[model samples]
Target: MAWRPTLIFTIFSTILTQSLAKGKSDSPICGILRTLPNATSNYSEKYCILFYKTISHLAGDEDSTLYLPVSDALEWDVCDETEPPPASLDIENRYIFVSSENNCSALERASRIQSLGGAGTLIVKEKLHAPKQNNTDYNFTLAFIQNSSYVKIMDGGENVTVGLYSPEDSLLPLSLVIIWFLAVFSVGVGAFWSGKVRHKLYLSEQCGHVGEDNPMTCREPALPHEETSMNLSAKSIIGFVVLMCTMLLSLYFFYHILVFVIIGMFCIASGSAVFCCLQPLISRIPCATCRTPYFNIYVVRGTLEVRQILLLIFSFGLSIVWVVMRKEPWAWILQDILGIAFSINVLRVLRLPSLKICTILLCGLVIYDIFFVFITPFITSDGKSIMVEVAKGGTSQEQLPMVLKVPNFAFLEISNICHITDNYNLLGFGDILIPGLLVSFVHSFDLQIGTPCHLYYLVNVIGYGTGLVVTFIALWLLNGAQPALLYLVPFTLIPTYIVAAIRGEVVAMWHGDSDKFESGESDMDSPEEGVPNGSAQIVT
Candidate 1:
């Protein structure tokens, strides 16, 4: 009775499965780890778990390179089959590396390394929960290249290291690229503006001189306009370069750098374009402030909330389409009808009822969205069911003559939602960028008395959101400002990296069973059942 890792791993996986919420399976974890930092820019992340499940049987472990999403953590959970495995309850409660990770509050994430026999078991979970999480302005974002053409074999004897890197690494490269492009475009625009300004001044001088100095007697040599052109162009260029470089460097260190990156990029592009191109052109025209740089804005739309209103409306419509695409209608029924009724009842008892209508409307909208966006996509797919089959000792495979064909429908079906939520994946700096720009805009128009402009207030509410008291005061004071929202829609496809790596590992794990067949076919699923010779189970 030699030690059997397959049997052991099966038990561990079963325990893990018991904790899953039907189709949910801690879906919020990924929201916290991947999407939030990437999209929201609201929270700081300390660490994450990188569950490495080998879909294919790996031969030797020397070549595998594991890249963890976070920089430092409290502990690592290694599900090794041969080693004395840190106590079961300890593994469950995460005592495996608790001593090293004592700085963090708790393990921020959990992951699994699922695979089949003749194999070593490994799962890496890093824990970093320091109380200083609040004091520092830090960003913990991760971008992994997990699924490549390499690292497929899933044999038991293998070694892997989960490499670490600091947060905001992705933003550095992305920001650098954007700033460089804009800097070049700004210079080109300035040159065009200088030409237009000169022409306007020439026309004015000629018109003024027609009645006085002998019908263009000397031409005045144009007053050496080159000096003025050089200064204007130089100022614009210097202003732009300085601003962009400042923002880019700021992102390298800020915890909420995602906001800076997104907002800073747009502001620099838009502001520079206007000052360098549109401003000069408009100045040459009869009117100065009358120039509208972009159509969706107010200077062009004439204080009509219609454009802003329409924008919000269109965004709502797109959100509706998103709900439809995700395929959940019941959630809509509950949120729109029942969720509304429930909120009214709760509000009635509370007695501070000015917001009853607004409350119901807001709650209903959120409820319907949840059903359409998050709740509706909870049904399990055929691939997910396949994991249960293999887990239960029911799957088989066959080996082809030249190449081995191990059909692991299960490996292809598992979820990657867990990994995405680690390290505030949803909360990135760019998430905060647009809002910051809005705040900057409001600052541009900041006033101490009377109501601020509707447009300024609108941008602030729709983008960054002033707190409840602030919103109340602003809306009370302005009465006409309507804001739009930054709606996030999660796509339906599983991340390509997670899908590819898992499938590859499943194939490698079943490599041994290939000895049963020659090539181009597997014995796991029989030809008679139309299961395509997928073989399984080897007692080595």
Candidate 2:
């Protein structure tokens, strides 16, 4: 178990090193280009454009609106001509489109367009470059558009008018609030349920060891085979991270072919997760006690209760239905439900043995996330982050199922124009599961110490929520994707360590003395004993 943490850390470090070595420069401003609704073009209505303002003061406001008609430059390469083409009435008050492959710079082209009375200049290019800034004063907005957009506009003819606007921020706050609630709920419930399961397992183990002279009869309770939690080792954590990197790369490179495979895997995993979530609740029903005859199938080890069997079939059936109806407007609801269940189950099954291991895992993953989200753009062939690309499903029509997505509920006409009508605010499962492991650990620790109120668990959960709020604020301010764990790791780990230190239990928490609780005497006479300390054994 100790090896998992080390393995995860090493993998993250390797990814960071490789990304830093191949880094390149990027433009400061990338805005959205949306075609008006009345356009006759058959092309995509929206595009991502890199904008540069000639007026230094206007640089601060990327979201400022610029609505103008577009016109082709007299010369395809605006820089090829020595003097601006004969001024035409058609060019005045319109955006001039030009090829960027010409020898002249973007500034020179913008100056020529300004001289021609054009409202703005749109330079078309296949490759991106940082436009050289000049001190000379000019009064026009200049931007670079992909050749694809230029071709589409040209094909659409004169009816295609475009506008530049920043991505919408209206839905960010609401979406973040919802996500925060879901994450907190998942962690709290998972920790509580995990503690209960461990206590039950401990009691069962104690009952099994009762001596012959004891009057009490020992009867084994029917429990799930996967009752034991797997503690993460330092080396296994490194291996796990390495595996994650490999999987990310694989998805990026082979998404077209592998997307179906990933979808199938998600269905299976989500089905099992759903079963795990529903089993306890259904089992509490009196009718659920009915059992089916024992079967000799190698996969199923013991006789399953009637309700458990029905629940398993129903869970799988739901996943299948989701897959079939995934393109429907209401499909996201099912996806979110499946995703939340999966995250909670993961937090319950995976254990971080100590605070030290938790710190290593969180810190390593933060660096890994930062590299992929912020740094990989410079290194990848396309000027896009590998993490974002994979999350967006690359060229595949099917999105990866590892995120919780909430659609923007706020109504805005611009949202439709920008082709964001169906867009969703996304939070990856990693964001929840990684920090959640620490929350789970502290809750178990609280039980071991026999605290009156599980102080560490509550504090860390609050810290996670605060950190998530900060992350959303950063995203809104920067108007870009942020590395959430960068904020989460500090907010969660520091406060937890401070609490432990104040109580003078730093050493105990560091090494996870809770593991020793398993050897403590069990009170067989009292069935109502509180949760015991130590790792829970998996009953086979």
Candidate 3:
């Protein structure tokens, strides 16, 4: 009779507890385990821990294993879940919700879940893919899981245990700073230096033009000619048309056949770059009878040496393989090497006459960049900025072929300061090409007049490096898309002009008399080739 009384009391107590739990309005849906045992003891059970915000908010190590009533099986698509949570669900108090919507940002998704009685939220994201373009303006406050497999497992409703670790937080590491500064500084200085050397070698191989006051002067008529306003305007129009077409083509190709387009571009650019780099060696070749050095393989039929052909083939093959490998270390290195080489070659070939002209061109480009990036949205029918859209679109997998990227691998844990991500600095060809043209021209001016100061070229190169650093700073501070040329133009132009003025070479350079020689009116001394008689001669 005593044992029967004890059994009846125990059964009554169990029934009372169950009824009270069902009636409670604030019950934990996921359930709470207040006293967590050793890690080994909990291995047999499937569970997931809640992630707290930061180290400062941590009360103790004991709170690390807290869980909630959110079940792994109750994945909700807020868009599809138009109806409110049913009364039977009773997941109001302690449960969080999960969302992976592509329509909105992580912050917006979290806000929606919060409105639906979720105490917390988790957003699943893919690696290297940020919020969509429209959502980039807002910073997300929710925790994002990057592991695709883990997200799938959690979303699949499998009986699995998940551990949420706080994101590893760090500042801009010293290793990233050094690597970024060195890469920018070296590329600027090295490309300028290589272009100067190549220019000298190119000038040396030309016959009848040796020791000319200005090599650019030898290819034009004796009479000086200036570009008319109409001519300049026409050139502007043509240039704009070509540039727009190229941008459209790039945008199209990038989306459709990214790997193939990138491979082709790399091959063409790197191949030409390698050829130009070998110009010095090619200039050393001696003709059997004439015993003269040759400057151009293009001008001389069948003049390409076997090694030069082989080198071109190898460079192209490597470029193709690198693209096929999706830019692995081997391919990445090749890309950077070729990018530098291409930059040097472009610097060597492109030229601007004077600081005044350089300033004017740069200022105009600054406006172009700014208008496209900031003002286009207001003017467009769709109210979307073309520059920002292009930067965001076709970038789903992080393969931007239009821009050359140099990865910072010096410290595996550090993020490069020039990047929004933890990878590399993205530099568009326009960033290098336009400013580099003027730098190369200044170098050529140095060679022509033999200026003792030698400060114009050096100061201009330094100015360019300074401009690049400023660009990085602007990108970080704005936390949005910036037209790099806006900063680049001012930084490059002012320092260069100040240095030129300080050296008292302003008039000489502005007039471009330093790079020209007074020749006879007779046509006999006229330039043999299509080279201009003066630095500023009209292209026509």
Q: Kindly indicate the candidate among 1 and 2 with the higher lDDT.
A: 2
lDDT of 3 by residue, 157-218 (tens): 42333333222312453433643454455346544664465345434434225436555544
Q: Best candidate, TM-score-wise?
A: 2
Positional deviation of residue 75's Cα in model 3 after best superposition, in angstroms: 9.2
lDDT of each: 0.24, 0.66, 0.46
Off by over 4 Å in 2: 1-107, 122-139, 142-167, 170-172, 206-213, 216-261, 283-292, 296-310, 322-332, 352-399, 407-425, 473-483, 507-540
Q: Could you tell which candidate, 1 or 2, scores higher by TM-score?
A: 2
How far in Å is the alpha carbon of 55 misplaced in model 3? 16
Cα error, residue 225 of model 1, in Å, equals 17
Comparing 1 and 3 on TM-score, the stronger one? 3
Q: lDDT tens digits, residues 1-540, model 1? A: 101221221112111110001112111111111111323233323223232111212212212422322211113332332433333222221111222222223222222211211011222223322211222221222122221101221111122112322221231233223322332222122222332333344344455557375555544443321211111122333443344334323432242433323323222222222222222233344432222232323112222223333333443343344233322322222222211221111111111111122123223332332332233235434323222222122222210010001111121111232222111101111212212222222222222112234333233333232222232233234432211111311100112113324544323212221222334322223222211122111110
TM-scores of all predicted structures:
0.22, 0.67, 0.59
Q: Flag regions of model 3 displaced more than 4 Å.
A: 1-161, 165-191, 194-265, 278-301, 304-306, 327-330, 393-400, 407-424, 513-540
